[model samples]
Target: MSYLKFDKTVMINLEESLTREVLRTNRKGAYHCTTVVDCNTRKYHGLLVMPVPAIDDDNHVLLSSMDETVIQHGAEFNLGLHKYQGNNFSPKGHKYIREYSSETVPRTVYRVGGVIFSKEKVFSLYENRIMIKYTLEDAHSATTLRFRPFLAFRSVKSLTQANGNVNQSFEEVTNGIKTCMYPGYPELYMQFNKKVKFVYEPNWYFGIEYPKEQERGYPYQEDLYVPGYFEVPIKKGESIIFSAGDSAVTTTRLKSLYEQEVDARTPRTSFFNCLKNSAQQFYFRPKEDDAYLLAGYPWFKVRARDLFVALPGCTLSIDDPVRFEKIMSTAVPALRAFMSQNSLDPVIRELEHPDVPLWAIWAIQQYAKAVGVEKARELYADFVHEILEYISGQKHPDMKLMDNGLLFANGRDKAITWMNSTINGKPVVSRSGYIVEFNSLWYNALCFYTELVGGAPVEKYDKIIKALDKSFPETFINGYNYLFDSVSGSTVDWSVRPNMIFAVALTYSPLTRMQKRSVLDIVTKELLTPKGLRSLSPKSGGYKPYYVGPQYERDLAYHQGTAWPWLLGAYLEAYLRVFGKGGVPFAERMLISMEEEMSLHCIGTIPELFDGNPPFTGRGAISFAMNVAAILRVVDLLKMYNAE
Candidate 1:
């Protein structure tokens, strides 16, 4: 049985069903998301969401949802649910849901009286389109299905209002109708494979509330426009395909187009198979022939730091070196100009993060391990050299080469590092100094570059390594035995954080065997949870056990003490490195919850984080790509250890 399949019990419970969401994505950047019961509780939930490059860079919710109704024997059953102002849910469509499964593409089975029908959603692998195929499983009598399409032509971050700006007009195509709500948006096509009657009654749907947005203290109420309904008859043992796309389709070939998409998908039989499939959803090939991994669903776009951090597991776990090369090339255009710009921030955001270059080098090293050093050099040597030279110069204050041969990143006013949560225009956790992970990654990058190509003066590189080896451990180690999180001008932020794991886990470390062991022991004792390591140990005064409430509270607790599942990969690496083969069973035990997680929350994918407290509840972004990659890495590491 598929673990993601929800039975009648889960489907009937409104509270439970609302909490569990399903996601489907096309490799070209379009996606479909909604609650298990087909009710949208969050502002991000939509039937079709995709980016419109001509209008704006961000994603827009062109088609919010399609409410379906079944009619038989002059009786009507509404199979759609909607939440309005004052916490009222209309129609209660989930009552008719027999089962909902995301095992393949999102499939929902509904039984309305003697008539049984199933709805399966599939996204085109190469285009911004979604097709929902409805099949009548059993019918005692003739039936009709009415589909009302709700349109929200606005950015995903904002809500829509019933304004005069909306163009309430539509044009008829072959077997579809094309409509554009306003200017600066793509024309949306709602089509079907067979003949269907379209009733043109356009009106605004007002007072719709999104609970998740209300909880986040944002404007939660919005109005969506409905472009009438389509009346399509249902025949026993027959299926009809409903297509929605940015551009008009060849309506006659709709079934063939959907069939091709379904046939192209890889079979997902096991939990790991589902995870591997979900991991593939993150990889999108944009116009430049460059493949980029989205950080997470709904909100996050591709970031320079997140791309590298997620690359190793995404590519190496699947043994796709060509994909690794494709993703790596996406960073080249900006990185090649880093030296001239005197800054390494490749993303459009104004913030400067020093960890981007560090993670990039680490990803390169991982690529080398996967496809050998020779192939890796042929692919990444020039890019790596350019990045190294850029970092080798005097740049931002938080990320600079110090006289003591250590890389110092002291982002005083700006939280430039990964602990980049700011509240009230100030950092929540101010970790600005010669951080442990920064130096370790810097050292690793330098060593990898030197090994790859030795054009740099050997004496200068050697001198820096010798000085770092002499000073890193001596200055950072506190009495409790782990390295300080950061140190700036005699002031040491001595909190135990997961960042120190990189000090031992990286290809080149600045720690001895004994020190590595000490660091691992401290981390395991205070920070290691079943899911991952906490951002801060409980011993620290700044620890926040729960990640809850609005934006400010969540941001303050984001890195304060929240347990990040992605950090588990690094901790497992350091644990295995220090303990060798003996750590395999324990590492395996730590990952057993992942199998359980496959059935919960966002089915078949790991959450971005969990609460710091016991019974660490999954929080933050659901279906996070980095978290999935981290788990894949640990699985690979354990397999290697067992082989040895």
Candidate 2:
């Protein structure tokens, strides 16, 4: 049996199948995302969702979905699912599903009467294309397959109505038809490996609902246009390949292209392998020379903080240091550009976030740990000095190095940290003033850079380092043996947040051994969950444990008490730091429970956050790069400890 196989019982149940989603990306900014039953619960779900740089930065759903029909003896059984108005599902093709597995490519097997059929899907690794291969495994007699294409041709964030503006005209290509819904959008080319019949009957399917959007209090209904259907004959043991892409391809090469893509996939045979495969999916290279790591699936773009935080674990933890260097080569220049000119790259955003440069240094620290300090210094020495000088010389707009040797930023008007959930243009949790993690990362970066350069650089920052050692504990560590979340002049926020975990987690932490133990104990007691650490402690006032309701309510709970899996990377690192080899068993148990997450929510990948309460349901973005990278880092840490 496949590691990620679901039987007929699970496949037929909408509750079990619809909540579990599968995602396939083409390394470029295109993807195919849908529920396990092939139903699109969200507007972002589509068969071919790709970025149109000319239209907008957002991904557009060119080919919304395709319905397949099995025709035998003049009777047709449509093997496709779509949710319409009034909580109804049309076609109801999920009932015919016998098994669904994704060990390599996503394959769905169906048994309609005496005929057995299967469909396998794979996204092209280097191009904006999605390929589906259909196999008629067994048939009592001859069978005919019919495919009807539904085109949305709208941005993922907006819904489209049945309008008079649609082009509605299509041109015939080799065994296919190419159509463009609107101007400034690339034409969609849908082709087959062999000859087929095309029927151009254009119509609009109205009131197609996306329940996920409805739940989130957004516009949930749209109209999809279907231009035509294709029909082809099939024998008992014959297979055909279908390709949908932005550009036209040679019809004869479709079969070979699909096979080559499938053959190159990494099998998700184990928990570690599953994470490794998911980590590689975040690689987004718009141009040949520029590469970036996307924050998460469905909606997230390439943000500066997420790229640096997720870089080491996503690449180095997967034992691919070459990728680590490759991504950094492009990213470091962007970082420099942002620092010097206050300019942001069009693709890589959020470079102005106060802690991004600090996170970049921390990422380089991870590289130094993996492949000696000498190599890291050889590559990142100038960049490291530039960042340090930028902050210390007061070149940053928001971040300021204080006389106390801690970095301070004002978040009263806007958010500067990663807990950047806001409502009505103001920060929800404005953790301003001297934040714990920022200082922790600052101290760590200073020490690492000083050591990387040795003698002179050590003396250069010695006074500031000494001041931080005394002032860090004096400002943050309270009488309760736990660090304060944030400290201002008159008021101090003592919320038990996961931010304090960085005080004990970083390589060159300023916290003493006893202080590290105390902080870890408080974190494990107050914020730690099976999924990860809660953003805020429940014991504090205004603690919202569950992340639900509409946009406003969800944003209120986004950082109040919602659990984030990315925090686990720091928690485990602190645990091992405080307990050494004796902590291995407990750390391993935490990781083992995380393995059960592979089969939950988004199969073989981790979500962005979860409910802080019991039965912690996964929420937010389906496949988060930071969550996957953090888990992979835990796996790497465990392997090193076990081998030692």
Candidate 3:
């Protein structure tokens, strides 16, 4: 039995299967995303979506989907599914699906009469290519296969119609055809391993509806162009490989390339292995020396905060310290460039976020713990010293090191923290001034940097450390025992948020053991859910638990009462910090509860967040890097505790 297998019952039911999506990505920022039944429910869902830097920054969907038809004895079975207008599905290929499994690569088995065929999809690990292998398991007589390619050469954020501007002509390649729908975009080469016949019948598929988009109050219908079809014959036990990519490839090596890619995949056999596999998917390497961790799948770009926050768990937790060093080596220079020259790297965005530098230091602290502090200091001592000086010296435009030894950020207009949902150019949750997490991270970074490079640097910031130790507890701790979310001069937001968990979770915290216990207990009581920790306590006013509805409504509720799985890393760390061996069982149970999520919304991967209320439904980005990384970190932590 496969770890992520759906039987015929679930496969045939549209309601159960359509909600479950599968995502595959390459290191070069190309992705293949669709539902389990191969139906695209969102505009982001596609067969080949990749970044077109020549056109723009956003990812463009070059190949929307491929419709496959199985023919036996001149009887054709159209094995392709598409949701049309009026809630209708065309071709209705999902009915032929006998089973869907994603243990290694995503494979779907189909049965038509006596014929049993399977389709396995593999995205090339290092290139912008997708390969599909069709195997005929059992057949009664001679069989033929036809593939129709759907083309949508537009940004994933926008849709296209039947435009006369599109160039319909295609050029012949090695046992294939290459077409470029528009200028400034890379030509997509679609090749088959074996000889096939290409019929050039250019037509537009109109009124294809994306229900996921309609539900989100966006334009849901669009037109996709079909560039004819490819026909080939197959024997009972024969397998044919089809490849689609931006560049042309040798037809003879397609099968060998597909096999090599499959051989390198890590099987999602268990909960931890599943997460580890998902973690590796976030890694994006556009250039030879440059590397980054994408924030999430389908939509998000490479964000600085997300990259740092997810780097350690995504790499270190998977027992790949070399990858961790590779990514950090690339990011540290970018961070320095931004700090000194105010130059943001084109690939990694949002470096100016007030808390990004702090999070970067935290990620390095994790690396320090993994490979002893001495080794980390030898490598990152200067970089760490530079970041600390930049923050404490008040070089950061958005963040200020105040007299009370806390970093104060003004989030009235622009969102400065990770709860960065904005509406009409203003932050939905204006967490300005002395934020609990910012100060906590600030104190932690200062302590870690000083500890990393002792002697002079330690003496230089000794008074500031003492000031934070005294002012942090007095300023944030309220009468309710839990720390305030933010303190703005005389005004205070007393919402019980998970932000305070960092105070106890950080390697070096300003809070006393008793204070840590109080903060952790409050978080566990009000914000903790089976999914993770809620952004805000439900008892607080303006708390909206469900992250649904239109864009505006969703943004309003995004951080109000939404439960974030990423926060579990901090909450669990704080739990172990306060309770030690006694908290291991509870922590284990919490981690076990997350195993159910591996089979949920996106198989073998965690979603960005969940609804804060019961039946904590997964929401937001289907496969989030932060959430996956956090879970992997917890798994690593548990292993260490068990060994002890």
Candidate 4:
């Protein structure tokens, strides 16, 4: 992506530590954040979490701490510390969502440490004071970092410690002042919520009160907005650290942390530093052997195979290939586990529960193909055996749904479409009954298995693929243009959507050029957005703009109308097929720009999703493996394009 098209205020560099950046968005969606860094601990720190002090209407500070467990909110009202109390079941979004505005403050303190040289960050919580510490030492000297964010009481202030509650409301606390000293290092770390607004108040204005203050060595630092730099004042082999959270003190003791720097000590060190710190903020548990670090976070967990759709962009390109294997291998057992539980159709891996749509399998096979053969042979064998079993059950001699060409999933409501199936209350199989995307997934999986294995009649799979190809265009044809959303004879849903793209991105089984063009034309005209292809049309009743909010509402916002960045991979693949690939081509430019913009969020990693609007902001997953996996595939494609 060229600098011109990629230009958008030069935003923070993906390569620099959060501490080294000039400005970052603070919690509550604010636009300004000034940070400080402690080079010894390698842990970053922050002050004034956000503009407006992150006091939401709910009367709670959203402690969106990724690594630390306790969010030590500095209390105001001059009555000392007043803790809000309430209990809210986190949808696991707690692993990622920094509800810097939750109504209650858990009595437990939040503490997360950043490892300057490790792969993961430590997050823990306690009461009263929150401290995060990291230590690393070589033969010469040991480097230890400890950050303590504590409650500060003003001199002669009349106040008492209050009870903590979760349902507490937001209240403005003082723009506190507290000074932490590391004899050797002074580049204190600071991390305010990036979603909030902040301005660096002058450091000189706050350094008062403490009589022994003017004796320390001068703190070397830089003013980060433009070209500036800051240095950690540690011995060549020693380290220093900083503690975060809104520490309380009268405005007199606020430390000087306003500085930034570009250029890295080592690409690998800087790279790992960012991931290590961010990791402290979220949870991604891989079942011992997954291809990606983790495709699951907070709530919306997906299948292991689904993660491959975005792998190469993850560890393959930038990280070690061996680590990538750990991620890929995880799918083997994941699939087996998913299939083993149910006997009705062993091949069906319940995509969470009740029904296993073929689309996920579609993506998995594609991922395997992308990974190449030797690395995926066992995966293929298991996949085929199960698929062949499924085919045996479903292919009623005539090769159709159940005993005929009807549309339904294993006796469920006929609307077994991927868009609208509900199981145990959770909306499963949404937009049901012979949905085009589902069938596309179905048809492609069949053809792919047939191509790989030498068991069933290859012609049988070929014929089905051909049949679906011909049937789709005609059955879905809408006279003037565009294909139907599904062929259960259901109406087109009257909403502009990008479900049709699957027919284009899928391999083997089908889609004619004109049909592809038609589908592409419809989507380009309606579904394309700055972030990604919108799932449902705004004109549709179900669409909802994504915003920070309560859980259910947020989940509803997801996919219902939210933009999915992962879809950009699908879109890019489709674009490559339609316009031919290569960065030289104009289409490739769009793709590259898309990649550049995405990489900016995590220094080259794709976000899970983005806002479904212009200036479409990437949201949720920071450094999510699945999303990055998709971008990696795109990168691979770009390379392939270049080779061609």
Candidate 5:
């Protein structure tokens, strides 16, 4: 049995197919993401979601979906499925699906009456284009396929309305038609490989609700414009290619273009390969030689902290040193851009997270190990010293250096850390002052700076290090052996959160051997799960078991108890550090448990987060770049320990 192929039993069931999603992305910030049955369940779901440089930097949903219908003789069978406003389904094409396989590219085989055909989808490697090949396997008579293009032409975060302002005209190109709905937006081209008839009928489909958006408490319903439909004749053993992109393609060269796209992708046959491929999808190179990683798919932008935390695993683990340097180069300019705005923050104020600059130092240290210290320092030393100086000089209300010589972030802005979910202006999971991970990252950053660049900075780092060594162990550790999550004025949050793992996992840990072992033991007993480590221990109060229901409810559980797969990287690193080579088996087993996930949701990619409870159902963003990087990092750790 193929790991990624769903049989008729699962495909025929609309509920089962709708819950699962498939995501195909080009490394250059473009994607085709939707449900397995071609029914969109989220506002972000689209056939051509790409960045329009002329309009804005954010991605937009141009073509929402393309519905295909098979016409034979005088009868027509709709092969496109859609979920309407009142839990009603139209066309219901999933019933005709015999099998859905993502073993290679996303391939679906459909059987209607006496006609048997298959559809394969492939996105372009570096462009905003998607090609769908429809092959008629065995048809009794002439079959004509009709393709209807649904247009959204709006930002992924917003809903589109059928307004009178939209242009309802098309410009004819070679075997294709190009049209633009709004000003400043890129023109969309719908091209066909064979001679086809374009029916110029425009109408509005109203009250299309996205259940995922509704759950997130956002406006989920919108009106989509159907520009027209393309009618193409087909016979048995013949295949036709349909292209949707901003630029028109040469119809005669469609086969070569499809072959090139398929050949460009790295085959995903195993867990490691699947993760490697997933890592590649996150690398977005907008300009020549400048690369940055988007944090997650279907809705996340390029976050500073996420870029540094996920860089080593996404690039280095796969042995792509060139990309590592490319990413580093881009970060320098990003920091420079922030500095230009006269802000001490690592990134812009809106995009700033206090811990991001600290994470950059940790990323530099990891990059140093891959490419020698001399080379790494030669490239990143200035960037590192500048960030450290900026962070040290600033004394913000939210993030400040206290008399205790440890960094403190006032839990006032809980969004400053990774547990950033908020409800009604209040943080769901508050970790305010003297955060564990922030301190650990700060300590490591200082140590790394002292080791790399010795000057006035070294003396300052030495004094802070001495003070942290005394204050950290004295104030944080409880009688239970594990450290407290955070310490405010008089209140000690003794929550068994997974943030403590970083203390032992970083390059320069302030925790001693005994302290590291205790932290690992407690984390293993409480937070560790098959999918990843839970944000909060189930034994703790206000532990959310499920990540469902409405927006506020989901936010309450997002960080309160959601299991984040990205934390597995830190857990695996700490396990190796504490137990040396002996911990290799445990790390291997942990990574192996997620192998079947390759065939599950977001096929071939790791998810953003999972539910805290048993059977840890993958939830949150479908395709997360950091989660894939975390898995790759764990694989690297295991290889190092097992080799010894």
Candidate 6:
């Protein structure tokens, strides 16, 4: 189920616009648990500030029993209240509130005590308190908000709440939120191809915050006296109300405003759906992620899935030839390093994931098909020599393999590659035989190398392929059920993760149809949740449900149990591999639901993961790359396969 809309009690002044807005969490909103936007602006600055003892309260949890909604609204946010008693002046400003630049934009901007928010003809205006009212029509709505500075911008300072009075004088009233975040002058920090960046600074304080999460706020560069603020529980499709003396007027007026305007809009065709779907592909995109993207919002590493999907996934129709080439451009380097490194010693190699997999050879062949055989061979020649050098190293005595070939102990965490950890906090899911995904990638490497350097590479690479073919079979658990992360000496025995989906989802894998079926069945049965695929089975003790919070706990929570919606594309791909290809709209129709739901939040993206239970708790995330990238590729697969 999605999140519930909250009825927030927002505090404002004489000069502020009397407008209201509903708060929403970007990702969780999909599951009906939406977050909210601040009134002063369409978007609010996300800061994890320390609480001032006065305004701070206990953690507030929201639960609508009948609706099956549960939300943890932490009390830490309310601690931002600091009393400003220093400067006193004749409070010239009458009212202060936030309003939007124009009615054309539903997203709002805040105004202070002296702002005027108004609407035009054919629409009723609710300008009683602060000249704030709205009217929506079928096509579009138009409105304007104007802000006037407080009495020549009087020496502003935090004042004590004179009993939380709304009509108190500016200097006497403990009001005015001092946020570096104030659209006060909300400015953009950086402009990237994909995202818009804005950095928040405290007006009075000089502190450098990583601005990461709530717990992550440790005095970094400078320890500015940054005080935190409280959050109100707000809901969707409803208005928030706050008043000191006249409760009846505020309610009666707001209700009248809603009833009067609700009838005017001939037909409201909300674009929430359009907003969700349009952000998926290369629509309106000025620039796409390079074939190799060094990420900021998304995590690190050159993602194989992201790149592969981005090529045909996002851009194939536009620059079909060039973008596809760009996708494979690094395939050569990635393969060469992989083979060389693994070839150094049988025990030394561990593979990540692959785009085309065995089809790397085929993808290369396809590249040749698109460009020419000469270009393909020429590109192959660029990196094949490194394989020989790595082979020399592998043949050496001192060259040892990590974890006897199954896993490699890397970093203090002992993680092997990216998907190297388990819920127990053990870094590598070290196991016997090659991981399904790893073997798939390795096989692709061999096939790709053989395609590049024919004679010697075919023979040499063939021998290694034979070893993998042998080791992989031995690794499969006829005794238990599925494959683990890797195969070497001691294997990580548990976890039927969705990693195998890639092995099947890849253009090709070394496994036979029978082998792929068994693995896919195990994953589908145990790991596949409705939202996506869970990291662990709910039936297992190791299972941890996904939610939000502090990192160390969150990381442990991240992969262990969270049902990642992005990973669902893998399942969609694999399912189509055997069962649905010849069928119409195999993947195309499948994504429409996700596109529809996800577009509700991130202007054009999907969340990192969702709750692994019924009603699918979508929380603590928004606009993750894997989600968008995977959809891109999966949609491409549907389009391409359908064309075929």
Using lDDT as the measure, the top candidate is: 2
User: Candidate 3: where is the Cα deviation over 4 Å?
Assistant: 454-457
lDDT of 5 by residue, 1-644 (tens): 45577889998887678778898898778999998889999999999999887877678999999888999988999988877867988888888999988766889999999999899999997889999999999999889999999999999889998789999999887777999999999899999888888999999999888988887778989999998888989989999999999888899999999999898877776788889888988888777767788888977878887888899989999999889888878786776556446454332123367787788788888888888778877988988888777767763446888777788887765577888888888788777888899999988888888778743457776888888889888878889999888898798898889999999898887889999999999999999988889999999999996888777788888977888888988898889888888888788888877786887778888888899888888888898877898889889777776676
lDDT minimum window of 10 residues, candidate 4: 98-107
Task: Score every model by TM-score.
Answer: 0.96, 0.99, 0.98, 0.56, 0.93, 0.53
Scored against the true structure, residue 41 in model 2 reaches a CA lDDT of 93
Candidate 3 C-alpha lDDT tens digits along 210-276: 9999989999999999989999999999999999999999989888899899899899999998999
Better of 3 and 6 by TM-score: 3
Q: Model 5 — TM-score against the truth?
A: 0.93
How well does candidate 1 score on lDDT at residue 324? 84
Who is ahead in lDDT, 4 or 5? 5
True-structure RMSD for candidate 2: 1.1
Given candidate 6, what's the lDDT at residue 92?
16
Estimate, for each residue in 80-181, the C-alpha lDDT of model 4 and write its tens digit: 111111311221211221111101111111112221221112111210112222223222332222122221111111111222321121223333122322
lDDT for each of the candidates? 0.83, 0.92, 0.92, 0.39, 0.85, 0.38
Question: What lDDT score is found at residue 375 in candidate 5?
Answer: 83
Q: Which of candidates 5 and 6 is the stronger one according to TM-score?
A: 5
The lowest-lDDT stretch of 10 consecutive residues in candidate 1 is: 343-352
* CA shift of 16, model 1, Å: 1.4
lDDT tens readout by residue for model 1, 33-130: 88888888888889999998887778899999999999998898999898997779988888999998876777899999888999998988788899
- Model 5, 157: alpha-carbon shift in Å? 2.5
Candidate 3 colliding pairs: none
lDDT of 6: 0.38
In candidate 1, how many Å is residue 598 off?
Answer: 2.1
Where does model 6 exceed 4 Å of error?
1-376, 384-413, 420-433, 451-457, 490-492, 580-589
